[model samples]
Target chain A: MTRILAVGRYSDVDAAALAAMGAQALPSAAALAALPAALRAEVHGVAFMGHESFGAAEMDLLPALRVIANFGVGYDNIDVGAATARKVLVTNTPEVLSDDVADLAVGMLIAQSRGFEAGIASVRSGDWQRRGPLPLARRVTGRRVGILGLGRIGREIADRLAGFRCQIHYCARTPRQTPGWTRHGDPLSLARAVDDLVVAVVGGEETRGLVSAEVIAALGPDGVLVNIARGSVVDEPALIAALEQGRLRGAALDVFWNEPAVDPRLAALPNLLPLPHVGSATVESRAAMGELQRRNLSAVLAGQAAVTPINAP
Target chain B: MTRILAVGRYSDVDAAALAAMGAQALPSAAALAALPAALRAEVHGVAFMGHESFGAAEMDLLPALRVIANFGVGYDNIDVGAATARKVLVTNTPEVLSDDVADLAVGMLIAQSRGFEAGIASVRSGDWQRRGPLPLARRVTGRRVGILGLGRIGREIADRLAGFRCQIHYCARTPRQTPGWTRHGDPLSLARAVDDLVVAVVGGEETRGLVSAEVIAALGPDGVLVNIARGSVVDEPALIAALEQGRLRGAALDVFWNEPAVDPRLAALPNLLPLPHVGSATVESRAAMGELQRRNLSAVLAGQAAVTPINAP
Candidate 1:
């Protein structure tokens, strides 16, 4: 039987299902760390959760490995260069997560702008019994939305926000004509022109520090910052400075710099709303991503190019 | 000059505007409390905030007082009986707040369903260093939505949800045929049939105890509740019980039993998301309501029926 080492922590697919397709599924993280030398030498492929970086030691074991299927859409954790040098194929579940992340960003904006969370907290705290005047709502409709890296996900966010009547603008590496969106040359320029700036770009060396303090400072206090992309894209220190100084009205983020161990400085600020990075956490979207990954794995093992391969690797 | 005891706080249309119309404005809350007997006898009308309940003492202000303009769509706060007994014309701002409230409810539904608050909290806390799995969203497009009442605001809520392609059912005093939405005979039947219940019933004695524990239990866990109507319409204790026990998946409430004091039970619960009643908090909506009240006050003082008279009180 063709053996496959699936390294991810969370997978919706059954092992028996993978076996049915003429492959063995090995997903225990502990097992991946302690594979017998003999067995490790025989493993022909590796699959893992879309969470983090795959180290060199694990890569050294799959001498005959030809394909790597990431469980989630992002592949920053995987060493694409090592895979490329070894002629390995890499695939990720893309568009499957677009709508869910878009949905999340839109929801965050609504909750923050309307003061829904704080209002809820106030009521829950018993401070609302006296029926004081209603705290105001920040107008969301007709506000300008500036998107960084208007790729597939960015475009989807734009499409969803279109329903709310916001004008859309985007900053990208190059200009492209999207029906309702106007294009700005890059991040700082885009931030200057809009009421809200959303970061939906990818994570990698090229994008590591793209959204620095300069960009955030340019966005200013009246501007709302939303990051649904990666923490690496933003300079955490700059974001904290902007938030502490009240240079930004509010921030809604789905990812953070040094996450899980989140910057403690950010944890203390009330202006920023944090989430435990669940952009594609919806039941429908996760299932769809898993199914898509499975299809890619099956196709690649069957000697076909993956349905959605990371072009660089 | 026409003497008018303007009981409500004025917007941009200040004393100057009223002065131009041959009316002198009283600016004190205490002045409102101690109306001069002679001035009270001379006043031809009164204008008030939506929050004020004109009690018997205030109602006995003037025999010449022909009209009262309420600065909100809801006249529930106004003691219409007292006004009616004195043959005073009472006009309320309506229709203006309908779309705004409906929009807010939908926004709340989307926020809670998508875990926007959680996402924001994660971002704010700096725990979002890496993108984690997102909670998959329940299919909002086709879920069953049960409305508590078939009044104007409820009807407007139905109108917006229609575009999402969901099945609509509502509980009302009597059944009425609208182009869309199926009317249920009562709350229990509607709760039993639908997946999401939206509260939009009127306030006060008749509908105060409407949504009981039994009705909420019938909705079941995974069933969501959204209340944009008066807080009394929902049995707060019952609803909180449902939320705590996981009998209901989530709830989005704007109104509370007490105005400024949020219920401690609700604030403590994570499943229930409360909003300080921002229904009709939009600038556009508020401005429109004010304009309508101004027009009504003008027309009534000119010896014409106000645009919207609630039982001539």
Candidate 2:
């Protein structure tokens, strides 16, 4: 019989469903290390939920673990190198949440560009009639938009934006086969080419601090930055400074370097539209992610190939 | 020489441009009525702005006025019947602002569904990490969306929503030739068919209170109402009552009946997402509208056909 270790804060419903799938619900990755060897030795798979660091040390505790299935498209929290080296397969839920994330990215861009906060405040503060008219917001449609990464989620954002008549520019290692979209050589160039930039790059060592100070500077005073990707990809201090000085127009961020604990300065800025790590937080996406995670766990436990494998065994 | 009257609050730049086009700039419609008979009688075209009523009385004052080129898509402020009865041509700036209006509508829907306010507050109040997790937001993708009037803006919204995998349904005077969209005969049937209803009907007497209490009741507790059209189209008191009683999920409104002076009750509702009447309040859209209005004014004053005519001469 296969035993699975489920980690992270799962809702009662999710926990119950995992229990039905025969997963032993462990609240945290730290809890797995504290488990009795007898119990840990029987665990063959992990149904992961939260952003807890899982490295070689944690992997060593689960000697019988054959697979780790992540509940999100971004699995940066899980050390794929360690899992691959240990011959453990890693799978992630992708495509399932792409629409939700892309939808948020487009929505945030429009909200920020359209000055939704001012609009809301106008109504809430009862200053709308007194103020006469709110300031005109920059247009979202027919403007130039740059996509940081032209991956699955990025492509979705770009495709949605194309309908708005935006001229699309993107930066990737190599230009893709997309027609009518301009390709830039680097992040700075990409930022310079468009009025708005949406970061959709993957997270990790190769892409860490990819959107640097130079890139932010190139984005200029009237440019808006929207980050639906990881926080590590952006220079937090530089971003805050630029926004404070009014060098950049605005930002709509879903991720942060120390999320949940986002920098107070970033939060205080009226121009910053901050969201919890909710790029894929919709009910439909969450259920699909859970289903995909379960399918991946069940497949590996059943000695079959994982559906959305992130690393080779 | 054809003398043109540029009415309403114009930006200094727009006023200057219209003056350079040989149009007399007036701050208000009342100013036009106050003009000397000699100056008023010479006015052959009016570049109108704002929502001051232009009825038979105003038309009687402008006996020489050949065309009223409205600076917005919605000309509910202009009595088309009176214009038509007097053999005066009425043209509106359409298509130019349609994309901007449609973009805002979709953005507001996504923002409300994703709980953008909570997300913004989570970061602003520095309670994101402390709060642990924000409540799951309803998904925008894959939901059924109903457009109250599938005109130009409605079609644009429906097209953009299709990319999100939403099922499109609509209510119009007659079923449009749009394939794959579910058409209903009345507003009540349209509300019943979709989870979200976006009011895109034209503003005026024929369509006033089109989305009545019966329609709202059909939309139910899990339903959201988005109004990007005129505020007069929706029953504001009924909407506010439903929101207060929790009979409806939420509403995102960019227009109000007495706008600028929005009902404080509607503004105070946590479930309501209020925007200053900014459906087409974007720089690009505003500039395009101004240009279109100028073109229409120039054409009619030059004894040429008016473009985008609302009422045939």
Candidate 3:
């Protein structure tokens, strides 16, 4: 009997890992809904991946669902409130992927500041020899940098930036004990205080559009924005306008409102460095995430608590 | 009287700064040689830039040249031995640009490891929509990283990587007081011990081809090579062969054997991230370098000591 349904796209390694645990694979939440009623009734937990929504309607399909083990740090797609209401535990793999996410965030910041895209293009097209030195890029070291959120991933990014000698400023509802780091009450104040702002906030209705137009403008014409958080956290149109009007210097984005199919305007900007949402996308991190997800599934299926539960349910 | 002749390329800001110091600008060493004997005789110092050879022949042309104020950290092109023999002091802008060089070095490491080139390409070409997530990149954080030469720039790179939780190992002729960092006696030992090797040795005859084929081989198929020091420090042909044969995973190069005109073979390799010698190429660092170069020029022209002399003559 299939005790677990591994939903969403899974790598071959992840699929094999799931199969070993008596779990059957489904391509997505839609696929899980299409499963025969008998099989759906047998599934006690879900090892979920991807950014597809899994709300109350999907929960009703699996009467025996005890837990949803999310394969990523962000659980915005899982509708935690609905899971809580239905008495189905929602667990997410965090901390394990923080290093990978922070690494990309810092990498993107440096890449944009140093104009890596133009530099690579010049070398590939033989333009370096033809045109001599590229226009000098801005220095990244010792600059003032702001973090939009001071969560697990945000703290990691700040810690890494400290090595670069950056003056770290962050915005959070309540200040934490981060010595040598300046704390701000709001995003606008934080953005105003720094030359670069990296979005590391959570993704959900409460935090949606947290990096609004005012925050972007406060960052000013010399400021750079790096978003490693959810796409909805930043106002895409405002960001687009800021770049288009030279109200902002540049941006490096790994996520977008419509990812995989990013807006053409954002993609066409010469000053923007666009990356396909690759945060937490590394062989090592993925393996760890899968292991954590499976552990959550195993614990919950055995009538115990989920390993990294989001709610008591 | 033109007390200082600013040789090689100069940005407008640098040229103006040079002019303020009662200096005249020449396009290159060739241009300096083309100057009339009377004009060359009046030049007390040469504020030099670029990678052109400046040996005894060029030194002989400027009979009254008291010092060469190089506008970059690397003074390899100045032929310091010849300067010493001729009783002409050689000064280079060093510490002022270390941060920028280190920044680019670390940036390139992360960029190459994360496959920034391919990620940017996929987004620009709209292949991200056509395709799904990119193949997982190797984790950069907490990896064993080796610095080939523990110089000022190399030390800076190691310091930054420490924040990423990297286990730092370095190769230096004589060990310094760097606690917690593993020091190796030779490049081969360093390569054998680490997953990544960053070349940060000085350039010139003594250090030419320091990262030879043997060293590249020891780094192995999973190893990455990052060269930010000088083109002469690494064996270009060996690097190309290693990448071509899959003997090494990848490389990120800021300097090349014949820069501006980088070898097409290296450029063609999918595994290599080739930059056009942009180690210290930033607006802030260049400005700082120019100021330091001028300070060296001014002091030398005034019959005092060169501020940052490579050789006292």
Best by DockQ: 3
lDDT of 3 by residue, B1-313 (tens): 6477888889999999888888888898987667899988887789899999898999999898789989888978888988999899999988888888888888888888888899998998899989777898878999899998898999999999999999999999999778589999989999999999999988999889989999999999999999998999999999999999999999999888998788999889989998888878888999899999888888877777777889877
lDDT of 2 by residue, B1-313 (tens): 7888889988777788899999888878877678899888888888999988888999889888889999999999998989999889999999988988999999999999899987887788877777688878888878899999999999999998887878999999887888689999999989989999999999999999999998998989999999999999999999999999999999999999897788889888989899988988988888888988998888887888878888776
lDDT of 1 by residue, B185-286 (tens): 889999999989999887767788688998899889888889888888888888888898898999888887876666678878777777878887766777
Candidate 2 has an interface RMSD (Å) of: 1.1
lDDT per residue for candidate 2 within A153-223, as digits (tens), equals 99999988987888999999987989679999889889888988999999988888998988989988989
Tens digits of per-residue lDDT, candidate 3, A24-90, equal 8889898766789998998888999989899989999998888999999898888788888888999
> How high is each candidate's interface RMSD, in Å?
3.3, 1.1, 0.8
What's the interface RMS deviation of candidate 3?
0.8
User: Which of the predicted structures, 1 or 2, would earn the higher lDDT when compared with the native?
Assistant: 2
> For each candidate, what's the DockQ?
0.42, 0.77, 0.86
Classified by CAPRI criteria, candidate 2 counts as medium
**Against the hidden true structure, what lDDT does model 1 obtain?**
0.75
Residue-level lDDT for A127 in candidate 1: 59
Q: In model 1, how large is the Cα lDDT of residue A276?
A: 72
Residue pairs clashing, model 2: A129-B260, A260-B129
Give the per-residue lDDT digits (tens) of candidate 1, residues A198-281: 899999788998888888888888888888899899988989999999998888777877767777788777777677777887
Indicate the TM-score of model 3: 0.98
CAPRI level of candidate 3 = high
